[model samples]
Target: MKRFLSGFLIGTAATVAAAASVVLTVKKQVIDPIDEQQVAHDEKRKRAMRKSAAR
Candidate 1:
């Protein structure tokens, strides 16, 4: 019973740590760049539309 409890606690800690790491990595690697790129893309599209409207 003691061994089982210890193993369960270890597994839970490992899973939580791994999840936090993945979330942090994804925020930096995937989410941040996508948000930046989307904002830039939207601004570019807006400028193009404005230019066409002016003409």
Candidate 2:
């Protein structure tokens, strides 16, 4: 019984670690780029607005 409990705990910890790794990987590979693109787009829009206002 003790061995089984230990195994269960270890498995749960591993699963949690794996889930966290996946989330971080996705954020780094996918979400971060999208956010960077959004920031760039916002900057471009602001520049265009300033140019139009100056005109």
Candidate 3:
């Protein structure tokens, strides 16, 4: 019973680690780019607004 419990815990930990790794990778590969683009877009919009307001 002890061995089985230990194995189960180890497996659970490994699964959680794998899931975390996948999430991080996805965030880096996919979400980060989108966030960067959004920031760039927002900056561009702000610049445009400022330019219009200046006129």
Candidate 4:
């Protein structure tokens, strides 16, 4: 019984650690500075083009 409990605890801890690492990686990708800036610049250019076309 003791051995089973120890194994279970270790497994649980490892799973939690892996999950935390995955979450951190995803968060970093979502908040990347270069991508965010590029997206903003692209949006501005599109808006400017639309306005020019309307003229």
Residue-level lDDT of model 3, residues 1-55, one tens digit each, is 9999999999999999999999999999999999999999999999999999999
How far does residue 25 in candidate 3 sit from its true spot (Å)? Answer: 1.1
Computed on alpha carbons, the lDDT of every model, listed in order, comes to 1.00, 1.00, 1.00, 0.94
Q: Write down the RMSD of all candidates, one decimal each.
A: 1.6, 0.6, 1.2, 3.4
lDDT string for model 1 (1-55, tens) is: 9999999999999999999999999999999999999999999999999999999
Model 4 over residues 1-55: C-alpha lDDT tens digits? 9999999999999999999999889878776767899999999999999999999
**What's the C-alpha lDDT at position 21 in model 2?**
100
Ranking by TM-score: 2, 3, 1, 4
Q: How much is the lDDT of residue 28 in candidate 3?
A: 100
Colliding residue pairs in candidate 3: none
TM-score of 2: 0.94
- In model 2, which regions exceed 4 Å deviation? none
Model 4, CA-based lDDT:
0.94
Q: Model 2, 1-55: lDDT tens per residue? A: 9999999999999999999999999999999999999999999999999999999
